[model samples]
Target: MKFTKFTGLLFVFMAIPFLTFAQDWHVGAFLGISNYSGDLTEQRVDLKYTRPALGLLVRKDINRYLSIRGAFTWGIVAAADSTNSSKALVARNLSFRSNVFEGSLIGEFNFMDLDEKGFTPYVFVGVAGFGFDPMARDQSGNWIRLRPLGTEGQALPQYPTRQPYDLFSFSFPFGAGLKAILSDKWTLGFEIGLRPTTTDYLDDVSTNYVDQNTLLAYRGQKSVDMAYRGDEVTGKLTPGTYPADGTKRGSPDHKDWYAFSGFTITYRLGASSGWGKVKSARCPVLRP
Candidate 1:
């Protein structure tokens, strides 16, 4: 009997902390422009363009002054045509594109503590983990890889002619925004954010191209006759022969990585209106 009572007491104590967290769990989604920054913007003529983002977020206001928030955003950033002159092109004319999958944790300090306040200005700082795939694809949809002659008969139908640049990095994220309560249960808000990453190759630097304005072959497909042979008599497709994929060490042309930014509009969920409330009996208060 004593053991049973002790176990019951332990369960109740553990449940208390979970109940506290349940009070602050709210679901929300945001729409906004997502763009890039850092080495990725070295040749981009315009720093700002509109992109849309949607994500689910969960936030817990530990107290009026401090809170923890987490979110996942699906977004993209792209830049093209950095150079006007084709002959003088130091940068490739290909589009430097990045699809960003992001997850972040933010700490917010709300100035106004009231839940009904129409506008609350807050400052936030957090770390974001971004999974980005940056690549350039030409019109024919074939990745560009330089290979030796005659080997075309033996090469894989898909030999990754143009390889993907996978950029995974830790970034410092910061922003300021206003949240307005449109009604009892709904809040509409917007935020502008900046993120700084540690990569210098975002613009595809370390190559003959200074920017991304010259690799325009990606704009459309043309079947141009080129020679690729891998045989002395009939060469075995040995690595490092011709039409090399940019990944080769000591290659003059290689892919680069970059950082980005975003603007977002978010909708908040709570007992206020969008969803029906739970039965009163399901929620029992602890009376001491």
Candidate 2:
């Protein structure tokens, strides 16, 4: 009897937190710009490559200072070596564009209560999964998918370790934002979030250049054409020869990263009137 009584008490104690929390939900839309960082970019965040981004998000504020958010975002990121100021990079002449879709779950921490301060600064960190396919324009101005061509010898038997990278990857998304309570029912905010990913192929550039002869023999002429683009600027590397096997094409030491910066507008639900405080059994506490 005593053990059963103890279990009952323990359950009540565990339930107290849920019972006291004022369930507040915020559904919102995010409008933003997306940018890419990788071997192709001259700077960590190349503004020249910025593109449009859009997302929908839902948030639940557990308390005055804490919340949970889930978001789905779509964006495009691109970069070109031709934009680089360095003559060597310009001559390399490689560029790519990737349309990406991401979904994330994050925990947010607010510095001040929006109900009282009217405005607050917040930060969040979360895990996200994103999908992307890199493509580049050919000499004919048609976009060609890069993965299937195995631009780095990914499809060749000689380079067994070089396999085609997956289209999906996991990332760590973390950033900060500022929020203002526009009304009891609406809130406005702006945020900048960065996602560092597990894969390095966001731009389809990594590791060394493959043997031109081998790549042509196995993957054909198009593969050779895309792999050694210096021909476009330098007029081909001595005809039958090219940047040979093991020539430096890209740095493999680091993975790729992307960022989203933009504005958000949210509508409150599930009792927006009882925003920051714990609830009572007899009455729902209203924000003043």
Candidate 3:
């Protein structure tokens, strides 16, 4: 299915509970850094490519130690093999940048009473769905979407194993954070969350290079040109130098991963109203 339609359904599913629960809620915004790990990243979790990320979240407290949250986040993730010091990677010279949009529903478990006046560490785990479009710059520096180019012989009858990847996929998100009560109605938090995704094409580089001649015949010269980007760094294309069909282009054993680390400031909804008072009385130890 298209990513937009899937996301719309996810929002509707999460929103239903909010309308029915009528519980204590907190609305917050976060600013942080995001990064990716995959074949193009040379297996290094480098901070050099970290990009700005922002998110909005709504949390409904189930008690002083547990809560449910729904969040939507936007971030940029990128990496380049050209920047690697390894000779093999520098020669590969592949790179990509993608904008990621993620929606998640998570359960948070606080190690201590969250309503207390001090700080507590918490862990969260949930299901997330995200959409990404990986892109790379052409010789002329124009950004070109890589998926449609069939860089790895995707969607071709000859390469049945190299099927096209979907732009939207599911993931498992789990992370830990610390939160502190700043006032009666405000809380400050810092967290780092990791997403282990189901797809390996987050960087648009996975599996082996296709037979150049066949790729050219089926997908056009642009596919053959992008299938192996080594020429981009060498400045000269060597005829018949492409990796043979079925030769390794990227590791297929491992999937991609992305992470976000940031700070959040939240406003406790209905903190001064009768509902708030009743909630505070029911959980007296949680009063901030």
Model 2 reaches what TM-score against the true structure?
Answer: 0.85
Q: What is the C-alpha RMSD of each candidate to the true structure, in Å?
A: 12.4, 7.3, 7.7
Give per-residue CA lDDT, model 3, range 1-288, as digits (tens).
689999999998998876555437989998999999999776647687999999999988888889899999999999988777787877787889999999999999999876643679999999999999999888888898999989998989988877889999988999999998776677899999999999999999878888899998888887777778777676343333578888888988999999978998888776322322445567456666
The candidate, 2 or 3, that scores higher on lDDT is 2
Residue 11 error, candidate 2, Å: 25
lDDT of each: 0.50, 0.88, 0.85
Top candidate (TM-score): 2
Residue 37 error for model 1, in Å? Answer: 2.5
| Cα lDDT tens digits for candidate 2, 1-288 | 999999999999997765554347788999999999999987789999889999999998888899899999999999998788877777788899999999999999999988777789999899999999999989999999999999999957999999889999999999999999887788999999999999999999999998888998999999888887777764432232368799889999999999989999998864555433423334865999
TM-scores for all candidates: the values are 0.58, 0.85, 0.84
Candidate 1, after superposition: displacement of residue 115 in Å? 1.7
Q: Count the backbone clashes (under 3 Å) in each candidate.
A: 40, 0, 0
Q: Sort by lDDT, best first: what order?
A: 2, 3, 1
| Residue runs of model 3 more than 4 Å from their true location after superposition | 1-23, 234-240, 272-288
Q: Model 2 clash tally?
A: 0
lDDT of 1 by residue, 1-288 (tens): 999999999999998776655545555776666665433234432455345566777777688567788988777666643332332121223344666788989897778853634558887888988876554444455533312211122122343343333367666778787766665555666676777665433433322211111122322112111111111111222322333443211122323322333333334443342223233325687999
Better of 1 and 3 by lDDT: 3
Poorly placed runs, candidate 1 (over 4 Å): 1-15, 38-49, 82-91, 114-116, 139-166, 206-288
